[model samples]
Target: MSFLELSLTLHARQQERVELALEDLGALSITLRDADADTPDERAIFEPGVGELPLWNEIVLDALFDSAADRSGLVHALHELVPGLAPDRFTFREVEDRDWTRAWIDRFKPMSFGARLWIYPSTVAPGADDADKIIVHLDPGLAFGTGTHPTTALCLEWLDATDLEGRTVIDYGCGSGVLAVAALKLGALRVIGVDNDPQAIEASRVNAERNGVADRIDLHLPEDFPRRRENILVANILAGPLADLAPLFADCVEPGGLLALSGILQGQEGELLVRYAQWFDDLAVAVREDWVRISGRRRG
Candidate 1:
């Protein structure tokens, strides 16, 4: 069946009301994207924490409806929902239905991190030359961390270079359990994956099982995670949260244990270093694109 897609560029403040109005008017689905995406003025907004709904200052809201539905009714409802919304800001188009899952999978191929680590969707098999590769089987889902982002790639590469043999690792803010699963497959005795989002926890579980390391990984929501010192701790969260959780992260690593942090923009490393210096030593930094990975050892 064909669908009618309506795209509206609106101020962030008006998003909720418009979305509700569209839903009331029988929108099948509503999705949002940053209107300034990929531009030099792009904003780096953190993923919302649980129970939080944050939007960009400028947003492109897309809503899908049955093609046979009343288009004029939708426009009228939107006008009433947002009194000052501009007519020129709305665009309507016909969308043909296709297998969206297959489309997404087609864009994701095997991606390599460093020399030894490889990430591939479950739909694809590794080549014969990948016999010695450390494979991480992941399928794109609601959670992030597919190793496509520079932040994730930096962490994955760092994991590849680290000697995880018999070490207990913790992946703070574990998304899709990619890093934690990689650690387990790389010989970590056990790994703990923690995230604030329940969806992320579930995604991590599924990815871990797919990688055949579910038995070696323990997934948890932040509040339910046990307080224990790990041999190595990695957090690929943004710089803001990394700084805020400095003490917590420090406490989770054993004295002299290693810590690796990513999701930091190039210019933001200094602030993080200063924050982490209170509990860690020998801090080093690695850069990929505008993102960086910082590693250090917990001091006694």
Candidate 2:
């Protein structure tokens, strides 16, 4: 498929009107990104909660239309709908669509964490040496956690280094079951995967099954969470929820168990360290790029 991509920048306040205008112009699809994303000071928006607009102060919208559409007509219509629309605001390019999944898989390749754990996409063939290394086969999908993001990479490194042999593990906020499946491959006896998104739970289950550890992991929504105290618990959710659920998380890990919290930005670790210190001892922090992972042992 081919498309004519029209890109322009607009203030967050004007997003709704611009989006409606693009739709009215028969745009096939629209993509919004932070216009100031190249600026180092711009904060990244990971995942927005339900009904929340994924917006920044300045947003760049790229509207796609049939390649044959009249470019001049689109420009005229947009300028008419938006008073004072600058001629410089509009940019055009022809784009060819390919299988996005295959494109992602090709770029992801094989990524290794810690001593012997590696994530491989289905397209790649592992070497004979992989017999000694723990392997996880994952495909790019709607759910998160493919070992690419700094946050997930930090958590995976923590999981890979930890001793999971014959222990029960909990993967709170398990996305795509990467950590849960990795823990199982690292020798964990059983894993409990919990996520609020039904799609995430399903993705986790499918990933677990794909790795031949489905029976060892149980996926659940928060409402039906078993809440069993486990030998190890790792949560790769944002810092806010990590702090809010501290007491609940504390209750989920038995005395003397292990824990790791991730999805925290660099400066945000201070509050989490203080809050988690109450129930966890020997707290330590690991940094990867701008992301932070805090690990500690449950106080006996």
Candidate 3:
């Protein structure tokens, strides 16, 4: 299916409000960008518990409009969400390639995390000799994750460095089930990946099989979250969701077990750390590019 692209520029402070409005209309994905494409000195978003999460003084919302109905739905939703805010300018055009997935493959490549891990997409791993590395086979097909992103890479590295042998692990917001699969590779006895998106869960299941560890990995939705605690838990979701899920993460990890989290802007780290401070001790962090990954043990 082809997608119609819609973009709008908004004041820095209004970006989140605009995103909420568009989300009410069901925007498949939204990304923030600078109008001038200027490289801001600060990070892009304020992430709690990471570095300083960027306040985003100015940004553009790039979203996909699947159809005319979708466009109308979004306009109506935005009007309702923000009583007076409307797009100052709007334009639409077909993305040329109906297969948006393939159009992006040229830019995607195998990424090495630190010096210990390398994530490989099935199509890109051919003739590679790093056979001993923790190789993850992800074919972005219909799913949303491949450990190439800084957030995912940070979390994967944490999992690799931690001692998971024979332990049970839970991957929260497990896009592509990459984290769970990585844990299994690191010797976790069993792992479960949970996400609200069914497509992500499906992709994760297939990827796990491709990695030859389907039997040890399970994928489900939030409604199906297991009742037991895991020895290690990891989540690479945004700061808001992470903060809201604190209690849940607290409940899911065994006492003294570690929880690694990412997908935060460098500035937001302090705020997020404060939220988790009560339940976790000695919150150590790992940094890659502009992203941050933090790990701490669940308090008993």
Give the top-scoring candidate (lDDT). Answer: 2
lDDT of 2 by residue, 17-52 (tens): 565556534455566777887773563533233235
Count of clashing pairs, candidate 1: 0
lDDT for model 2, please. 0.80
Candidate 2's TM-score reads 0.71
TM-score between model 3 and native: 0.71
Candidate 1 per-residue C-alpha lDDT over 50-78 given as tens digits, one digit per residue, 9 for 90 to 100: 23454678888877765765677568656
TM-score of each: 0.70, 0.71, 0.71
Which portions of model 2 miss their true places by more than 4 Å? Answer: 1-98
- Estimate every model's Cα lDDT from 0 to 1: 0.79, 0.80, 0.70
Worst lDDT run of 10 residues, candidate 1, spans 43-52
* Cα lDDT, model 2, residue 184: 96
Candidate 3, run of 10 with poorest lDDT: 45-54
Off by over 4 Å in 1: 1-98
Q: Clashes in each model (backbone N, CA, C under 3 Å)?
A: 0, 0, 19
Q: What digit string (tens of lDDT, one per residue) describes model 3 on residues 111-168?
A: 7665456677666854656767777776544444466556777887787788888999
In angstroms, give how far residue 205 of model 1 lies from its true place.
0.5
